[model samples]
Target chain A: MTYRIDNLQYANWSEKIFRQMREGGVDAVHVTISYHENFRETVLNFEQWNRWFEQFPDLIFHGQWGSDVRKARETGRTAIFFGFQNPSPIEDDIDLVEILHKLGARFMQLTYNNQSLLATGCYEADDSGITRMGKQVIKEMNRVGLVIDMSHSADRSTIEAAEISERPITITHANLHSWQPALRNKRDDVVRAVTENGGMMGFSMYPHHLKDKSNCTVESFCEMIARAAETFGAEHFGLGSDLCQDQPDSIVEWMRVGRWSKEIDYGEGSAAAPGFPPQPDWFKDNRDFGNIENGLRKIGFSESETAGIMGNNWLRFYDENFGPQQI
Target chain B: MTYRIDNLQYANWSEKIFRQMREGGVDAVHVTISYHENFRETVLNFEQWNRWFEQFPDLIFHGQWGSDVRKARETGRTAIFFGFQNPSPIEDDIDLVEILHKLGARFMQLTYNNQSLLATGCYEADDSGITRMGKQVIKEMNRVGLVIDMSHSADRSTIEAAEISERPITITHANLHSWQPALRNKRDDVVRAVTENGGMMGFSMYPHHLKDKSNCTVESFCEMIARAAETFGAEHFGLGSDLCQDQPDSIVEWMRVGRWSKEIDYGEGSAAAPGFPPQPDWFKDNRDFGNIENGLRKIGFSESETAGIMGNNWLRFYDENFGPQQI
Candidate 1:
């Protein structure tokens, strides 16, 4: 059965957003539960999401395993799989990898636009690559089925993480640097390495990662995916959409520079617009997922390939990777 | 002008211990503030210590710099320097290294009788050496004046840490494995490597690490120290004592196992004991430090050598190492 999954989103979650997820027929979504939150703060976020799930049972439910996507499909509700765009939730404890996994966190990035205990983020001047804790955490994450997401990690760290991870890791929300040359985007070598190792790359719809920013056409974006699929296997890519819908500019500040710096880090932005750039008109929210689906078909992906890009590939990946290794 | 400092201790901190330190003329002490606690929990431990400092300013005050040791001597109080037996206090965040230093953590063990994010403990069957995060943490610790203590770490990891650290690291407790051949003791090679790198070795009086356990003689202990001094420079050796005065057996469970294990870890202890063994009759408490002093003198040490071994050497080390590198 076909399933539509947005591999990443950090919306100002509300009943309205939950309804929009249902409206979008989004069977599953990997939601960013923590940006800079530590273990306790992130647990608080989880508790908040718990309340949302209870209040909006008809529209959403917690997704612990990949099979939950099917559960969401059967129940006509969206499955919310928890993820972290940064490793802050686990802090410095490698043991927390299993604990966070048990708490329903499925994906965690090693770094988020800075040097973390694990890896160098995309914004750091020097990319030290996977650190001592990073390597250990990667092992623990792999052991416990917490997919290593290198969305905002620096080039060398990201590549090293891909190589170091035992399981296929992911970039939950990012684009190809070859298409737009953005700092948050992955270069061809990184893309090649990730896909070569059976890892997934969820192309980002975040404006900063786009070529024309907020004005990027759906046609052009889909064309980029088509090209990416040609360069990297089509099976290894999906939509992450980094859709930070309805979040205030303050949240963006928290995202780009969470407690790490006193000065505001206008990452991938200038002083003129140090906030979330306006998302492209065709992809404003979860409800607009159809725009990319149709655009993918128009960009000449086979129907099966489009379905895979839309979500089936992710579902397959989840089926294979989102549980303790059988061995 | 000589000062007396116990380079490590995790006593059941109390007025009794403070008075005993005063009676014994201990100018300062490096106290273990955390074993398995996370940053927040460790902060709570710091808060507890803060309360102690507030309640007994005449007996003890928080020590941040080597100068504080001098201040303690002049003010007739024991300066309490904070340390962690395990890296759990920092959890997984590299940034916390600086934060912990600012909070007055002067010494941090890379590992404590098990594998940590930093290094392999002596208890582990295989020693992988200083980890990725361990290397980074060593550098950060060196930069921030947090001495890296590898007292409970495996041979390779301890040697690697000493080699990697830009500043001198330490083994704040534990005698020579050549003397006792215990799990927590350091080998001759490890000792050679540490002292060669200008690091200090604070000999432990913990019964489990002693040559004859609770029956070990002061003469034998000091003789071992003399041999260690001859082998690895008398200037690099001092007393840590590792005094756990007044602590209950339950506290031993917390020290050895913490939350990392569900079952009790009989680290350096057999199932027959599984607790803090009785102190040797000659060194039952802080007051017994004099016994060691006299013993060192009887072991054919020069007056200055004995004074240095008792504490002057550690004081000099503190002055040289307890700050950021002077560029």
Candidate 2:
């Protein structure tokens, strides 16, 4: 065994997509359950997922541990893991870190696209790193095994989070800015800071983070991963497709505006194309994991290294980080 | 051994009160953490209690089960159990019944002193009984072991709750309306419906529920209990106190008019006296449990019966009702 894991996705979930995950042999996917919802609203989302798990028990199950990936393989089902793309689920309460973790949230980004109570987002001009509550929440998250995700955070905040977290944090879905020059993508220094602290970088398949938007080739994407592997070791890379499949353009507005702004914040998109950008043809949905795997092998990566990039690295990271830290 | 459990209290909690509980040999207390707060505000209240438990570990600890009373006795500390006087902490979501229970809420009233989403309160003009959501919430509460408390609900609602709930519900702090006709007290049919269905009724120490307000005698109170024992068995009764010790009048206003009213709603108090009523001399604080014990004995009760009313009855109830139902 090697495992196929897409560590990030916010799809318009349906039976069709769940079937696609099974067809793709995707063992586990870290699905974003909340973007800007508050605690009660996020719980409603969990309740909705609970209904989904009940309705489609044979197709999918709620994943909590790394072993669940192996269990999913044996059972012939896809394991869906929960995460938050924003810290809004916790509001201002530090104790909710433990509460939400107990409710099966494994990953939470400190910010989304603006200044949050915890940390500054990449879109903010002044990145104040982490706030006072941020440090306390990080300690609590470390204690409770809620993995810190700085995927949408500023460079300073992302760097500080890697330094502050006792457990290895993650940038769950983004590419290198050195490759695409997108604001959402991490710079070389930011990626190095995270990987140096034993964290993982998940290559995103979202068009905005690609080399040439939706026109980017699999060759270019694989080459970027090859460069990252040479710079930061192969064990620190995995796929976090950020696959927002089948979601409407209005959903993108909710993700970007989200009750915080009265004006539109066309994050990564211009005024004309102000919606979720189209995915590159090579990587469109869950079934495209094979294309990326073959591309990695074609880019001069050995079998073991390709296995690590495909999913085993995330499985190892999950085994080590998704529980209370040993004293 | 007999346990000294006060099943209801909403005090201005401090080291002084905790020490007083120890002086009275009290083992456990189900403290009201929220009166009318929504889910988030209620969590803030729990956080405050968390701080208190941290600051005074030797004096108090968070209690979740009947066994914790024994643990408290062994450790020589008071085990503080959490409760909500209204269903506001759960908002309109039925799933929060389990969420709040996991956060250590042992009891929750269906209503306060006004009409709630679940049921009609005592002060309401008509008793419409339990709502459709109330039936679902009762089942959820039963499954999760969060006891339904109808101490502030109207007579019809109380009776309906007892009929609907699968597990034993509680009137955590109230008295018999037959003895003293107060709005907040339970009527004969209401008390009978609860106790006959294996529920517990905790006698209130609030002056408004007494025969002569603040001038009520211990002998009179004990005689009322003796009659109640004959009517509804000695095993179904215990002390709740309803002791709002050291709370200011402003706190009472918040309880009675928590974002629900524009004008003042004094609840049990009148316009002339809109604050917490004075406690009788016989039972002013936790240090006075001995007084009630003596009075019960003087009123022709046996030692075991006196112990049962003092706390043993509640401990037995806790043992049976504070865990997931046996399916």
Top candidate on lDDT is 2
| Candidate 2 - chain A - TM | 0.99
Over B1-327, each residue of candidate 2 has an lDDT whose tens digit, in order, gives 778999999999889999999999999999999887788889999999999999999999999999999999999999999999988787655678888999999999998876665676787655557754566678888998999999998888899899999899999998999899998888889999999999999999999999999999999999999999999999999999999999999998888766543356677788999988899999999999999999999999999999899999999999999899989
Question: Which portions of model 1 miss their true places by more than 4 Å?
Answer: A65-77, A92-99, A114-144, A154-167, A270-273, B11-24, B43-79, B85-327
Rate residue B255 of model 1 by lDDT.
Answer: 77
Error of 1 at B140 (Å): 12
Regions of model 2 farther than 4 Å from truth: B1-327
Q: Look at candidate 1 and tell me the lDDT of residue A121.
A: 72
Q: Write the per-residue lDDT of candidate 2 for residues A163-200, one digit (tens) a residue.
A: 99888999999998999999999999999999998899
Model 2, residue A191: distance off in Å is 0.6
Lowest lDDT block of 10, candidate 2 chain A:
A256-265
TM-score of chain A of each: 0.98, 0.99
Residue A292's lDDT in candidate 2: 92
Worst 10 residues of 2 chain B by lDDT: B257-266
